[model samples]
Target chain A: AQSVAQPEDQVNVAEGNPLTVKCTYSVSGNPYLFWYVQYPNRGLQFLLKYITGDNLVKGSYGFEAEFNKSQTSFHLKKPSALVSDSALYFCAVNYGGSYIPTFGRGTSLIVHP
Target chain B: DTAVSQTPKYLVTQMGNDKSIKCEQNLGHDTMYWYKQDSKKFLKIMFSYNNKELIINETVPNRFSPKSPDKAHLNLHINSLELGDSAVYFCASSQAQTRNEQFFGPGTRLTVL
Candidate 1:
């Protein structure tokens, strides 16, 4: 079984400051990791995914995440946070042979201006 | 054009009631999935269908059933709903062969009273 964990329940950052949201996963084989963002009352929107190669992956809306194999971690990061970036963020994982992905309890991000 | 769409953005029903949420995707993806986000913001995968065939069914109770009559549409039906069933249901789709970044619909918020 594949599972994901977001250690932080909430992350608060100020606009123009760097922000980070932590995530980790466990899977049988190679892991497919993903990050998604959800605004109020909306569905999840894909941010970025780590399939293979390149530990650092860039995604929509100036978001990026680094996949660390040794630590089994994939952390979302942004160089500068914006008030618009405040939302609920989720981490998900899918193993090599599994078609279904597992998601983490989302972390609420608050970017105050 | 909307990539993925779900109908009945909000649904409120009493216990034991039956209801269905309709989903459609114009992205021409082959894999579609259903997910539930509880009040605590924990998201879990419930079902996945590829090419109108059931591919992934999680430990969800039999009261929840998913139907995919065509590639572009997937619908979820819930029977004898319980208070625990109150959550946000999301429909998402991804191309199985290529980039697997799943696109999600707005989601249906089901409130079981």
Candidate 2:
């Protein structure tokens, strides 16, 4: 079985400061990791994905994630946070020959002004 | 234009009642999925269809049935709604069953009283 985990239920960062939301995964085969963002009353939007790529992956809205194989982690990061960037973040993991992906319990990101 | 869209953005119904949520994608994707996001923000995949064929079916109850009339549409029908079923239901799609990033519809928030 494959699974993803967002250790933090919530993350708070001041505006203009860097923000990081941690994610880790467990899979039997090669992992295809993805990050998504969801605002209140909205569906999730794709942020980025790591599928046999460089360690660092850039995504929408000035966000990026580092895929660390040794740590089995894919942490979402933003160089500078904005109040408008506050939303719920989700990490999902899928493996080869699998049609289903397992999503982590979301992490609420609060960018305080 | 929205790449993916769902009908009935909000639904409030009594327990034991039946309801249906509709989803459509204009992205010309070949796969569609249904996911349930609980209040605690835990996301679980319920069903998946590829080109109108059922491909993935999770351990969901028999009361819940997903129908994909075509490659562009997937609708979920619940026979008996329960309070535990109250959650945000999301519909998503990917280019194929491969490791492509998914596009999600603006979720339908279902509340069973």
Clashing pairs in 1: none
Tens digit per residue, CA lDDT, model 1, B1-113: 88999999999999999999999999889999899888888887898889645765647999999898889999999999999999999999998733277899999999999
**How many angstroms is residue B46 displaced in model 1 relative to the true structure, after the best TM-score fit?**
0.8
The per-residue C-alpha lDDT of model 2 at residue B55 equals 59
Question: What tens-digit string does per-residue lDDT give for candidate 2 at B6-106?
Answer: 99999999999999999999999989999998888778889888864675554799899988888899999999899999999999999775589899999
Location of the lowest summed lDDT over 10 successive residues in candidate 2 chain B: B50-59
lDDT of 1 by residue, A1-113 (tens): 77888999999999999999999999989899999999998889999999999999999999999999999999999999999999999998987677778789989999999
DockQ score of each predicted structure, in the order shown: 0.62, 0.80
List candidate 1 stretches off by more than 4 Å: B52-58, B97-99
Query: Residue A1 in candidate 1 has what lDDT?
Result: 79
- TM-score, cand. 2 vs. native: 0.95
Quantify all predictions' global Cα lDDT against the true fold.
Answer: 0.91, 0.91
